[model samples]
Target: MFTSMTVINILLSLVFLYFLGKYLLNMYFEGINRPEQWAGKLKQGKITRELQKAQRQYGDKSRFFLFWLQIERIKKEQIQGTFAELGVYKGDSARILHLMEPTRKIHLFDTFEGFIVADLAKEKGEAASYTPTNFSDTSVDEVKRFLGNSDTFVFYKGHFPESAQSLDTEKYAFVNIDVDLYNPTKAGLEYFYPRLSPGGVIIIHDYSYKWEGLVKAVDEFVRGIPENLVLSPDTDGSVLIIKNSVHT
Candidate 1:
């Protein structure tokens, strides 16, 4: 029979072997599945700097970083059209878009007075959990100042779909939709998706499980659409719907 010390040593050796095997297997798979762009290195140049500044001002580093990357991809792919933001809460995100593409007309839409009751009615689960009028303190003037008061930026201060009517037949290259409630989120997708240029991007915020209504809205809207949905790997709960390019 084995001694007590020997038995303990054998057990320890078995545990070590198991961990060692797992580590080697993980390393082998990681090497094979390495991405084209290494995650270890920092992204360089103007977009990176702009993203850094945006994260500092807006506090959603991941969202801004991903937005910058998407903008870069759009430029690389030569996607054309204007930019837009549906829920311009304090205009921080709008500012980021303007800074990245100053020449492009960036439309900012919001009531500047908070959510409407009808929109919140589409929300699932407990209604009280949703803040209907949370983003009311901001104004069009405030957004202008926040975005350097640029003429290229247009603010439509009212309910969307209604406010969006004035846009006419304009196509969008990049649109960020952050209307948290179900009705507006679904409405935004309906309005923007048709207008989204081939190769354009539509990023809808709050699509995670935390906002069941928002996810529900996006799911219902994209059912018959040809575009693909990509969920952001960020806590802000954004999702990207990329319009298929004609050339592709």
Candidate 2:
């Protein structure tokens, strides 16, 4: 039943797939076998196996590396407080954050179910295209399992700010705010910045033009704060806030 052209087309498709598969395999093997492109010797490089694991787990190598570097500085400076993540998606960054500093407890907050309808209503740019179900792929249980629910991991499965109501008195050394919309991004700043300890670090992700709402929220928030905005080169871009030292 196969026509001459159809058979030729099938053979061509198979050849293309075979070469494509081989190329991907070669790329992965080459990456694994080579030295990490970011750091040097483990001692001076500060490159642990965990960082390598995080590199593999995280979507943006620079962002994960930025987290690792900032946390190390936090420790060296003896910033004293717990950690918090305003928006956790499948616990990828949260797991790396926890692993980087296992002693510090990490409070994870998210709707887990996904974007709230209200939050998306006024959004613009890349966020306007999203639906309420866009980020609802995984659940709290799935993320918890991924994070191993270790003693240092705490889960708050609901809308943030609302989820953080009981923790008003809590102080944080590190806060990662990754909610993609404007309202939550603004709310995260209002709540976490005041609670952030002196010398604490906060990172708000999605600061690029692709997510105009997030960018606008961060821009407005940073304008009011004493800390200067430090931008990262991560794929989605992230804005960093390092609380001023007590002496400053």
Candidate 3:
């Protein structure tokens, strides 16, 4: 018995609320994410293109902002080594990280074909229901095209650990692991932690309970490492590991 006008009004109200909520969230996040150096960076126009993109396009500003702050800290501390990402689903985060520091080389590892069957088999929680096809929509060529200029970028188009075999003693300043399951996340930690430079960083995405397998992997890995995890207030719950300046 609702009139057409009433329906239209309800829809309009919902649309207004949606935008209002988003605006409120962005404002709140900006306050906390803005560091003491933020004003200086803005006044000096020192903000990276990636940070701007995160602020304008990404829904999880909390997570992206935290990444920006961490990268700043790393640079300030004079951390040495290249950057890397284990799950380059579509080169989004990789692009962000690269643009943040275009001078450093960033290694991108992915199947370019989605989750591996072997890896997917061990998933639990939200990722448990995913199949090989879950994230298979992307390709290395596509990612490269999106990121533009291949300079300072390296693509390892295959399963990780194996894909990263070419990596030997090279140190890493920052590594991002967003594989969304247990095995590869664990593998990434195993391969990168030892190679991570002292005071380097590794960020693991999906560390919340929704990805039980990811949680399990991180929990087990952290127990064996000297650094503790610093959780992020992002959309998917990211966790960080900043390597000790001197540790085994």
Give candidate 3 misplaced runs (Cα > 4 Å).
1-33
RMSD of 2: 4.3
Q: Which lDDT tens digits does candidate 2 get at residues 1-248? A: 99999999999999999989866775685366444434354537555687555666455656777887888789889998999998898888898898788889999999998999999999989899989888799898898788884889888989877998888899999999999999999999999999988999999988888998888888898889888999888778888999998783
lDDT tens digits, residues 49-105, model 1? Answer: 654445445545467667877887887788989999999989877888877777889
lDDT of each: 0.79, 0.85, 0.87
Let me know the TM-score candidate 1 reaches against the reference structure.
0.78
The true-structure Cα RMSD of candidate 3 reads 3.2
TM-score of each: 0.78, 0.83, 0.86
Error of 2 at 46 (Å): 6.7
TM-score, cand. 2: 0.83
The lDDT ranking, best first, is: 3, 2, 1
Clashing pairs in 2: none
* lDDT tens digits by residue: candidate 3, 28-146: 76767666676578779898656665666766767776777888888999999999999998899888887677789999999999988899887777897999998899998899999
